[model samples]
Target: MQSLSNRLQTQPDASTATALLQLQAQVDGDPSPAPSSDLDGMSLGGLKRKRCRGDFEVCALGGEVGRDVVERGLVTGEEAALYFGTFFQGCDKYVPVFDPSYDTFDSIRRRSSMLFDTIITIGCRAENGAVSSQYQALSNTTKSPIAEVLLGTTLPSIETIQALLINACYSEKGWMLTSMAVRMALDLELPDAYTQLCEIMLQGSDNVERERDLFRKARVWFGTFVLEHILSLDCGKRPGVRADGVAMRRCRVLLGSSARTTLDFRLLAQVEVCELLSSGDAGADVLLALAHDRLSPRVGVALSDRELGEIVQGTRIDLSIWLSDWITLVETAGATEEEKASLVVNLKIQRDWSEMTMLCKGLQGIGIDNVAIMSEEQRNLIRLAKISAQRHMSTIMSNTGLYLGGFRYGMDFVWAKCAFSVLLLLKLTRLLPESSNMPQLIADSKVLLAELSKVRGLNNIYFRILSLSVEKCERALKEDLAQAANPQNSGTQLNFPDAEMEFQSYVPKEFILEWSFPGLTFCWIPFDFQDLLMDFGSGL
Candidate 1:
């Protein structure tokens, strides 16, 4: 049998749990010296597990953490409640998964130990070392003991899955944790008719029983599906859940809500995005024939300009229809001010992304060398891209809190939109050097990026890279423009036949590859561009 330690090592989402266990060992002054030999091939199951006698630390501030435990961590019940409210409330709004009315404190403590541990860990990290030096210390630790718990306990229950997801939402390493939760959820095989039948039979009232059990489970499963899909989409990976399986029409009936809520609309919008990006329908492929060829040079022959224009038009119409449906639903849903503002901004960001994708496709179809003398269709595509880029930046500025908090609350796609928008500006500057607004756009993006960097302990690596990449792109543009202004002072002779190709090559290929971002290596989507620019450093 696999040892507990080995099992914990295998689980991706167990980082926080594993770290806590290690900390507990250190705090208790574990006398068990480090291992003498590398037990690479040996199993550790035979070793006796250490049992700490101290009372467990309750993360909530100003709440009872039991009277007995020594070395109490800084968290009080009040603070823990706040973290839960901020990170999990968005989903709970629609699904009613964390309903306090139904979930008593004792019930949660007994049933959701894993969740309790996770919340405390997250609170420590978020505190930024203010409460104690250990908070900062725990924030740096990356180890997890997730496997031991999984092996030692019975198969995970739905309640356990719910806690794991809530924990994942607040975690810095969300994608890994969410991936593990997705697997466990699948293994649990939740929402089957047998469980619903049992609940109905037990309660003697189908409506009341279904409301408590069936609807609850359905909502939890939908939330899981939404997170799983969004994580996969943002990282450019194939989603683990089936899109058709979580259809909104069926979910609404299962939820039993009088009208669809904001959370439901958000989930539906995400599902649509997943479909839009990953759909393999023949019609979409035919529409994007040129883009398909540009993405993969092996196809050799590319589609004509007319064909590319037709594809862009088709994509626009599809996006329009998708937006209209969601807009109507959101307007009807009685959402709070914060929810309304965030949801509307999210939709706008998605629209901008869709517009950027289509326009870039059109630009690629025309061949970069000919952009200086563009056709009406090509110019329109460029114009649309610029407008969308500006709109995305402005939207983010207006709703700064939403996108910044997005890093912590499972709204990573919002940040991904911001990163992609910066790239769009880089592309525009490189292709349309003469456009007066490009310089102002680049400067505005830098200002916004600097503000994002101010976020305490931000975990998104790609977002950080935006600052460096933008600076490099701007420097390259300056050099190219200087050479153009004074050809006599150029340091080196240009060997390339076309100046446009030379200017295009200045940006590095490393930044363009989707896998350049962490945790995206396994993604097979054609969206990952290997290199749009050759060398931004060289003179055009």
Candidate 2:
């Protein structure tokens, strides 16, 4: 009988070939297989395995066939190119760590098939329905590999981290994926890449390619850090990555370097915004801590109305300053008029969002026990929150094109922010007297939510929640208007038997548990709408 190695080398299947390669590498005292000049006579799946081992030519020739055979899917070279172009053009702007000029489809595919598939999935999902129909199959193909990497069954690389971060923007398990990405990034010591790159710069190394590679790794770490904060804010959880002043300084220096692009500047600006929003001094942070205590058995001291006011005012001032500084930088950064407009719009929206967050925190801090005789400061905070919600919703409504066009391509947090604005407006409408423009605002918000819901690849939970919430709010507002118009009916309460049943039917319990509303914790229970609405009015 022939030896095991001889049998494997003579007629190797994909699994046996991989095992043989690993054994050979172990014998050679190297963990990775070395490049071999001799080509193995293997089938398509085995060819895919060889391609994964750095045979670029094999991948270039049989890439589609190998993927079709292994993943049970097919993406022709032309389709791959189109999807790659789509991702870099639309989606890559938000996640700017990946450089299209440097990482072409062929190059990325050669580096990691998982990353390649992730890019294609996102790109496909960003397209119109006709094109996006392929998204599900492609996305399905990526799940197994991603799970393997996440479970430690497959070793992770920087490419895996990038794939996870990008997919997290669209995945239902976004928070989990983001947490894993941060952990993998730390394990890879990506945070230290910047220091090493700086050392090389100081040493006067003339290796441009080496410097570029280090910059990419540094960008990846920053991307992970930024994503961690964004997802944390969305879920009302503390970020996995702590605030690092030295890391921020390093990021600033990197952005100021000649190699920095407009995208890098935008990412740095996001880092700064997240930093300010998550600061201990920020009202959002205070509220998050309070929320934790509320959910726990331990009783915590509530902030005085005066203290809450100060926090809100201080947060507003900080947000204003931050916005002003970034606006100036954005204008002077040599970006085009369109880019400037988009940046300014985003900044103003964030400013409004932060203000609303602070005001909501203030509202929550003011206990409902004394709703009838609320403090003047508390009333003022409610007024400010209402105005901020109005302004934020108005911005979203007016920039319908921007949000709708970019919704599929941007981060999931954008959808969360929009949902928060709608819910805030709903809460404030009940707390405060009905304004002349409240109906119009509600109508516009409905339209905005409807359009956003139509965006491809959007998480359906957001749409279902927002749609049902808006419907209930509108019905309640109409009832209030009717009661005021007729004194006899003023004492009569509106019943929502059908609405309640529909909401229960549409919104699953798991979705309620999974989807965290930023400031509207009460929204998790649709059945408690009456109580929550009364609670909002209780502090009025």
Q: CA lDDT, every prediction?
A: 0.49, 0.62
TM-score of model number 2: 0.75
Error of 1 at 89 (Å): 6.9
Query: Which consecutive 10 residues in model 1 have the weakest lDDT in total?
Result: 519-528
Candidate 1 C-alpha lDDT tens digits along 162-213: 6656555544445566666666655554434323533444455647545555
lDDT per residue, candidate 2, 337-439, as tens digits? 8777777787777678767766665565454422335667777777787888888888878888775667766655565556657866766655565463767
Best by lDDT: 2
Error of 1 at 538 (Å): 21
**Alpha-carbon RMSD, candidate 2:** 10.4
Candidate 1 residues lying further than 4 Å off, grouped into runs, are 1-82, 85-107, 127-145, 148-154, 163-179, 191-209, 245-262, 272-312, 354-387, 405-417, 433-436, 457-463, 480-540
Segments in model 2 whose C-alpha atoms lie over 4 Å from true places: 1-73, 128-133, 196-207, 246-250, 274-298, 365-374, 410-413, 434-436, 449-461, 492-512, 518-540
